[model samples]
Structures are given as C-alpha cells and as structure tokens.
Target: MQLRLPTSIPEVQECLADGAVPIGGATLVWAAWQRDGFPELAVSLRELPEANTIGAEELGAAVVLHQIDDRVPEVLHRAAAGVGTGAVRRAATVGGNLVGSTLRCLLPAAVVLDARAVVLEPEGHFETDLSDVLAKHHLLVGLRWSAPIISGYRKLDAEAGGPPPFVVASALHADDGGNRLRVAVRDGYEVLSGTVACAEDSADVLDTLHRTDLGTLDPTAWETVRRHVTELLTRSVGG
Candidate 1:
C-alpha cells in the first residue's frame, strides 16, 4: 500500500531494515499484488544508480533483462534472450528474474557460471552463491562471476517463444590438462547439476550428466535431453 523510493544502497538497506519489500521494475511485484493484496511497505530501488549499472565485477540487480542480454556473458545472454517478449524483457529487472521466479532460464545459466550474489541483509552486505541466495529469501543487490572459457544454453520448449519445461546450460573451463565441464538443468521446480572432467572421453561426460538425479524428469526423457545437451556442449567447445 505504501511506496518509498531509495536513491542509494544504504537507503535501500535502511528501508529493508524497516520491513519494506524491495521492488524493481515491479513487473512481478505488481502481478503478485494484483492477485493478492499489496504489502504494507514497498521500497523502489529504481532511484538507486548502482542498482541499474552493469560493471566488470558485478551486475546491478535493477538492470533490465535486455541489458543483460546485450552486455553479460554469452550463457546469460542466451538465457535472457529466451525470457519474455521484447516489452516484458525491457521492463523486467535481473534481480526480479533471479528472485521472483522459480523455473527461470537465467538461474541455471548462472549456476553453470558459478555466479555469486551480493545481498543486503539487516546485518550488512555479504557475498554468497547464487543457488544459496535463491534458496533463501534474501535481498539481492548485485551478481558477480568470472567469465568461463566457453558456455552454451539450450531450452526445450513445447511452443515457440514460450517458457520451456526444461532448460539446460553448460560451461567449460580449462583446469589442468583437461577441461572442467559443468552442466545444469532447470526442470520446473527442480534443478539438476553435475560436473565431469572432459579429458579423453566425451561420452563419460554424458554419462555423468545422466547420473544426475533430476527429480522432475523421467529417466528416458532425461537421457534424450542429456544427449541433446551433450551435442550442444560439444559444438560450443568446438570439439
């Protein structure tokens, strides 16, 4: 019912301490409010400059989805490209996408990239894994991660441009003599993740992926998806 616009991170934190729900773009918040009732105190982070900026180390939470598609890593860009329509993408914030939704395209991509979220708590700001932050109801301020050597994302959808029932993202990083391949799958409410060493056998990587316990998908269907994802990763790694 009540709205407060904060211009700085400290002000945003103070508002949060006062029990205000942080809002960015308000696409998700407005939808929830329309379905249910509005919260007692709502804080708008739009006025904060840092919340809207994208930098080398961190991406501001309030940065719009389209900007992320343009400026972030290729995996995140691919994920953002699959989000909503152009209008919705223009209005949706990165933080909102990360925090408001459960089966989102970006979360799995972020997971494969080993992204970390910088959150604002009542105590102070702290950096934590993106998966951990998603598990808890934390106030996310920014996201941080180092770019990988190669990354790819694919979503298997029933309809064109619609949200897919299953989404997969893979990232490869040079580790000693071999490469470390990380794959993550987002299937409805369940997230399945696995890592394997891509040294001599690529089939071994696929086998490790099949071994992941994706609770939402059946074994047969998961095998099919795993094959497709392995092909995608192989092409991305140019191997």
Candidate 2:
C-alpha cells in the first residue's frame, strides 16, 4: 500500500485526483481496513494545517474529538464527549466522525446548529448543508456555522458505556417577539429535525415536540425521551 501525506490543500487534491482514499485520524478507516483489507493508495490528511485547525466560525475536518469537546460550543462538546472513550476521542477526527457514520452524535448536533460543510469537489470547493453533505458522498473539508443563542445535546444508551440508541440536539435563538427552537434527533439509523416557536412552559414545549415528527422512536420510550429533551431545552434556555 502507498501512503501519501499531503501538507497542503492542493497537494491533497492532487492525491485525490490520483485515486487515493483520504484518511483523517484513521480511527475508523484503520479498523475498516483491518476487516476488509487496506486500499492500494491512501492519503493522510493529518499534515494539512487547514484540516486540523479550529477557526472562528469553522472547524477543520481533522480536528480531534477531544479538542472539539474542549473548545467548541457546549452542544458540540457534549456530542464529542460521548464519542467513545478518552483514547478514542484522542484519535477520532470531527470529519471522520461525520463522514464515516450516520449514527454518530456530532451529525445531529451539526444539524441543529445549522452547520454547513465545506466540501472539496472535482470542480472546486463549495458549501452545503450538513444534512445534504451527509446524504451524498462528498470529500468533507470542514464545518462552518454561526453561533446560536444557546444549545444542548443529549444521548441515551440502552446500557452504560454502550453505543447510544438515541441522540438529540437542541438549539434556541431569539427571534422578533419570542425565541425559535430547533431540534434534531438521531434514532440509530436516520436523523429527524423540526423547528418551532419556543414555548414558555416545559410541558408546552414537550407537547410541541410530540407534534413535531422526530423520526421513528420506540413508542414505549418516546415519552421518556421527550421529557428528557424538554428538560435539556429548558435548562439551556433558562426557562
């Protein structure tokens, strides 16, 4: 196998043009390789500065999970902190987490944050919504978004230290007369999102959430999750 380390965007693009598979952190990629055999040529993005830095409004795809947990918004930090363990966080990159799997915590948070992804296409770099980027295969370069007024993330696992069965993220923004609430839920397979005017009471907010489709959740646990999400939103908005 040939390993190419590209320190610049142009160099990385050249490598991609040569049919080299891109790797960031390689946590998931290396595991996949071990199970399904390694690729002939792989491009390592660790050397690219833009792929590892945290900008004012953007996070490089290669930024480590722990860095995000430590530096980014609390919503993103909560998502990052649930990624696995301390060692896993050290080796997992935000880009890898997003593009590697649809079942990750960060994607839901990104959706609620109205994050856009910078994708490197054959023509040139362009911006797309995180949801759209996830739907289609794209070379993700980084993520960008304006900070919201307040945000929160919650993950529910079947058991302690196990993969989360459900993950939810909520963000609130002050509007003309009231507040706007945005919520995104990832229930194992797909992500569902909805937005509504923030309600004054937690019960009213919970009712609105129930009316807003949150994808397929177990009926037995739906109420439980709804209450949890309502509490999270309430605490975040100080309501």
Candidate 3:
C-alpha cells in the first residue's frame, strides 16, 4: 500500500511509530510475505547512511551481502558467499536475512559471533545483546562484534534446491580466562545458539541444538541439521 523511504534514523523511527513496517532489500518479502499480501504502511531503510555500515566490527541492517569483507570474520564471509546467486547477493541485506519469518544462513554466523544489535525502539534507540533485540522483535539498525581467534561455518543445501540452506557457524573468542566457544545452528525455521568455556568443555556443540523446538523434523531434516553442526564442531577444534 503506502511506502515511506526515510533518510535519517529519527525519520525512520517516526515512520515506524506511525505504524509503518520496516523494509530492507525486500528480497525475503517475496518468499515469506507475498502470499499474505504486503503490509499497508512500510518504511525503507535503504537510504539511511547508518544502515550502510560495513566496517569490520559493525554491520548495518541494510548492508548488502556483497559489501561484506574478510575483515568481519571468515565465517561470515563464507556464509554470505554461499547464500545465493551473485545477483541475489548484490541485493540481499543483512536485516532482511535476519528478520524474515525464517532466515538466510547469515543469522547463525551472527549468533556465533556474539553480535550485538543497534536498534530503534519506540522510546528511543539503544544497543543490546543481539539475542535480546531478536527476542523482543525490535527494529534492528546494525550489528557489532569483535574479531574472534578462530571462526568457521558449514551449510547443508536444501534438497528441493531453492530454499536457504541449513547452516552452522562457530567462533572462538578470547576471554580473560581462556578462549570461549560459541556455536550456532540454523534450520529452516530459526537460528539457535549455545557455548562452552573452551574446546575441552565438550567434544561437540550438540547440546546447543534443541530438537524439540524444531517441532516436527523428519529423519532427513534432523540428519542434515546434525550433520552440519558436527561439521562445524569438527572444523572449530581441528578434528
């Protein structure tokens, strides 16, 4: 119905407060929203400079996958590179990947990276743990994460061949005590995460996966999910 393209965060917030739905690249829209019909009032984040942050530690919501660089993390780069065709990569935004009804592989990488989200809420803008922003359904503006000592990613393609793949990403970040292991798994439904103090805490990140949350997974889906997670764990510890 109606579309508002705001160039500033305040303007974007205003549009949102006025009941406008936030839109990024709209690539995910065709897959998840087309059948339901589009929202009546929508605001585009594309024109805002803040939504274009592609630096090493920060990634704006509207940042396209093509703009991602090696500086962010190898896991992120590999996941972004495997998402879709070159044209899709050129148009898909990180926000779209994370906020869509499901997800594009990138969400798992963001989770493992322990990324924090910068968001615009009704009260004002604020930064919080990425999981909090996601759980509360806030409008994400950008993401920030530190470089990890080691990072890795793996994806299991959809057999039907069109849907986004199941992905698992891992990162080992240094802490005062030691390097901590962060692992995330993304099925077709959502992204999930877990961690261990170090590689010795557990041989695998299998505990991170909550199968019951997946509802009904046929043997095929479960195996693929398990397979990727195992692959990431293997790579993470050099097994």
TM-score of each: 0.85, 0.86, 0.77
Ranking by lDDT: 2, 1, 3
Question: Which portions of model 2 miss their true places by more than 4 Å?
Answer: 160-163, 236-239
Model with the higher TM-score, candidate 1 or 2: 2
lDDT tens digits, residue span 138-210, model 3: 8889988998877888777576657556676778788887767676767666666666665453433444343
TM-score of the candidate numbered 1?
0.85
lDDT of 1 at 168: 73
lDDT of each: 0.76, 0.77, 0.75
Best by lDDT: 2
Candidate No. with top TM-score: 2
lDDT of 1 at 159: 69
lDDT of 3 at 229: 49
Model 3 per-residue lDDT at 28: 74
